[model samples]
Target: MTTQSIKVTIKRGPDGQGAFDVPAHDNQTVLDVVSWVQQNADPTLSYRFACRVGMCGSCAMMVNGVPRWTCRTHISKVIKDGAVTIAPLRNLPVIKDLVVDMDPFFDKWVEAEGVHHGSLTRHDPIAPVDETSATRVEANAGIECINCSVCYAACDTVAGNPDYLGPAALQRAWTLLNDAKDEGRGAILDAVSGSGGCHNCHSIGSCTTYCPNDLDPMSAIAGLKRETTKSFFRRGR
Candidate 1:
């Protein structure tokens, strides 16, 4: 029996597509294929991976036109016609072959006030929190996000508007908004209600659809919209 081979197409910076042939293996991951190409075929190829397990979320990329965790994505699951297309995450500047600039993705966190702001100081004791509280429930929903940027790359709003605070950032802000210990909800709400904030999201739900961690960023964004609108009305009262 003849061993089968697979063709992989990678998107290179400004230049174009780069194709490579690799031997096929059972239960091979997309990351495994990319690593093989880099080690055997092209040594100049550049990409990023840390944990190789899905926990780190650093190895996410576009596989066959959808942003996914390459380390966890099996070739058998995504192979099309004995081929696969690997590309950098979308909605960010490409730095080199299969590498993208993450500065902008993180900057949106500042825009959305995603940072935690608590009134308690180190001198102060940790406040007792009720795990079953509604606010805690809301915060827990989005707390598992690993700053993967996959949801941001998959978001259509981020693709169209450069200033739009992407899904990860806004989802983070929503969680902080509900955090009982956070003292910045008012200011965060103000930021999220601004021009490129939660109101700009069209609720297309692409962010929710593509999140590898199964988070519903669309729901979080909607909560921000409702709360912000209510805050706006209360100020006028």
Candidate 2:
């Protein structure tokens, strides 16, 4: 219900000190302001978004130095002094303007073996698993991840060491590790073990602090440390 014009400033490129000044409404989200500028003020301004309603992970950016979903971020809360600074999400290669290269962010998922791998035979009798089972409940917590990379972008671990697989991807691996159907749980754990893997997570939890979806990636990383340690005893049969 605010009726004032919002002062919005956007950092146009990687290491860009210059900013694009734009006029925005108090009620408008940061995403709305950026779109308006692209449509009316600067046609060449580059950014990325899809499903502006907040379901798609494409619209994440740095709103006043915090990685967040621009579509859902309100100007009022972000701009305490009536001024806003928009920039590309942190810990990634800035391609141009507000757009960033997402390849490295996604590559970590593969590194952690985030994909599900099960060897269930459809011809065999179906196993009746309780809907309220503990494993299922634990997996449910991580199932809502939208892969926005905000957690990865906010993580100091990822920022310091580029090879680190990151919290989001590691969290995905943790979900699979507890799955009864996942035959690759052992391999997934193997992939995520060691220094550059789960052990390197300092548990500073910047990922959980900045995750827009309210996920606790820090706990997931802890799970990896526990499970991988247990597996060490069983190694080599």
Give the alpha-carbon lDDT of every model.
0.93, 0.84
lDDT string for model 1 (1-237, tens) is 033988899998686879988999988899999999999999999999999989999899999999999999999888888889999999999999889999999999998899999777899989988999999999999999999999998999989999999899999999999898889988899989998999999999999999999999999999999999999999999
What's model 1's lDDT at 56? 92
Deviation in Å, model 2, residue 116 alpha carbon: 1.0
- RMSD values, in order shown: 1.4, 2.1
The TM-score obtained by model 2 is 0.92
Backbone clash count for every predicted candidate, in the order shown: 0, 0
Residue 132's lDDT in candidate 1: 100
Q: What is the lDDT of residue 35 in candidate 2?
A: 91
TM-scores, in order shown?
Answer: 0.98, 0.92
